[model samples]
Target chain A: MTLLECKNISKKYGEKEILKNINLSLPSDKIIGLLGKNGAGKSTLIKLINDLLTPTEGEITVKGKPIGVESKRSIAYLPERTYLDKRMTVQAVLTYFSDFYDNFDRQKAEKLLAALDLDPKERLLKMSKGMQEKVQLVLVMSRKADMYILDEPLGGVDPATRDYILNTILSNFAQGASVLISTHLISDVERILDEVIFIDKGQVVLQESADELRTREGGSVDEIFRRMFRC
Target chain B: MDFVFDNNIPIYIQLVEQLKTYIVSGALAAGERLPSVRELAMMTKVNPNTVQKALGELENLGLIYTERTNGKFVSCDSEKIYALRLEYAKNISAEYLAGMKKLGFSAEQAVIYLEDLGGEDFDTSGM
Candidate 1:
């Protein structure tokens, strides 16, 4: 079944259009990469799916239903910016997530925290930016949601930590669920992606299987992205 | 059990090649049970779907087989595996000869050079 679909979606801010007539249908049980350069409306499309921003035209649906409370219940979203309370300790954040989301697995969150070597008693304000991001990832992934939408999960981290993050994402993976990771770091995440959506200037230029793309283009996804969007 | 991949190629093809290498090298011995797809994916740090595809390819090549109840295992056919080892060795020799040819060495000269190197402790660290 299609996990999520966006039909003729368009967004406008004032008189300027942010997204064109975009159409997409993400499949279930796959890890999809939403790839684009900065300011290419990648976040706008994600926000529309999450129901954080309203589309000026067209419709967005999750599991065949319109985006609303029902859709939100099925989606675990990690926005690009930090939204957690800075004063809350890691344990408190876990409790907060468990309380808000019915599918949240507190034990899984705790296990991930331990595996990542994060102290539950550490305050969010005291943790570095990367550590805080790790906490957010643990929280989002702990939920037993149908779909996961992560925006720039690998942004601004060292290479070693990036590998750990990717490993964590794949290790905690549950069958029959879909993960949508949006980022510009194509090479970092390409190997793990089942499919890739290349969006440029508010339009999707290509949507294809990652391995097939590698075979057809004779290069990595990062190389193709560079050749397509080179200045 | 390091499975490093070149991003330019299809990951499944690389997985198939690496697993074949393991099988022929006796690292993954014949009749040894294969790890679960999820475990292999985690170990190799790729998607489970990609790992599944690679295993399917290996199965088609008669290098691995799946039992209905039990998990997958390396093929127990010693003759088939021996044939694969010869094929792998031939490919390596061909590649080395191609490299030597690029440096203006004939096939006979390359063989002679290999014999000369084999007679001494050829340290690869300098290269």
Candidate 2:
């Protein structure tokens, strides 16, 4: 069964159409990279899937149902912006998540927090931007959701922290769960991707397995993207 | 043992070669059980499916084996491992010689450089 499917999906804000006739079906048990440049409507597409925004046209299904409460429940999303309350302590935020999501694993989050040396008593506002990102990742990953959607996960962090983020994601990966990672930093996360969907100018220019893309293009995904979408 | 990857190459293939090197170098001792696929994935920061693919290749090469109920194990067949080690050694040695040759050294001079670098037993017969 496909984890998520978006058919003829398009979104508009007043006069600006962000995505156009987008068709994508994500299968279980793969790490798929959603590659695109800034302002390429990647965030808009993600928001549409999470039901944070309604698409102007077309439909999206999660586990074969239209985007609704069940679809929302099935997807664990980390949006580009931080959504945690600034005043809440790390432990308090974990409690907030646990109170909301039935699948949230408090114990697992605690373990990950300890591993990353993040203080549970510290307020989210007190932590550095990098640490905040890690904390957010820990919370999101602790949930055993069917599909994990991470947006710009590698942005604005040191390389070492970025690596930890990747390891945390992989470590929490459940069997048969698909991960849709939307990032512009192709080189950093490209190795872990099983499939890649390249979105250019609000449309999917290419969707292929990562290895096949590499083999066919005779270059890394980053290199191919550079040449394909050169300025 | 650090496993480095080349972005230009298929990651699973690199994993296979690196894991084989671990077996060949005794870093992964003979008959030792390997880590679970998820554990390996976290350690290497690759996807679980790709790591499994690499393990599958290692199993096909007889460098690793599955014990069914138990996890994968490095092969207990010491001779096969010895043969693999020799093959890797020869390939690496040839690469080193080629590098030295590219710097305008004759085969004999390259062997002398290898000797100085403690690369003993570089047979000069081919020269």
Question: What DockQ was computed for model 2?
Answer: 0.68
**Which pairs clash inside model 1?**
none
Model 2 misplaced regions, further than 4 Å: B103-106, B118-127
Q: How far off is each candidate at the interface, as Cα RMSD in Å?
A: 0.5, 0.8
* Model-by-model DockQ, in order: 0.82, 0.68
TM-score of chain A of each: 0.98, 0.98
Best candidate (score: TM-score):
1
In model 1, the runs with Cα more than 4 Å from the true position are B101-109, B118-127
Q: In model 1, what is the error at residue A74, expressed in angstroms? A: 1.3
lDDT of 1 by residue, B9-110 (tens): 999999999999999999999999999999999999999999999999999999999998899999999899999999999999999999988987778777
What TM-score does prediction 2 earn?
0.93
**Candidate 2 backbone overlaps, count:** 0
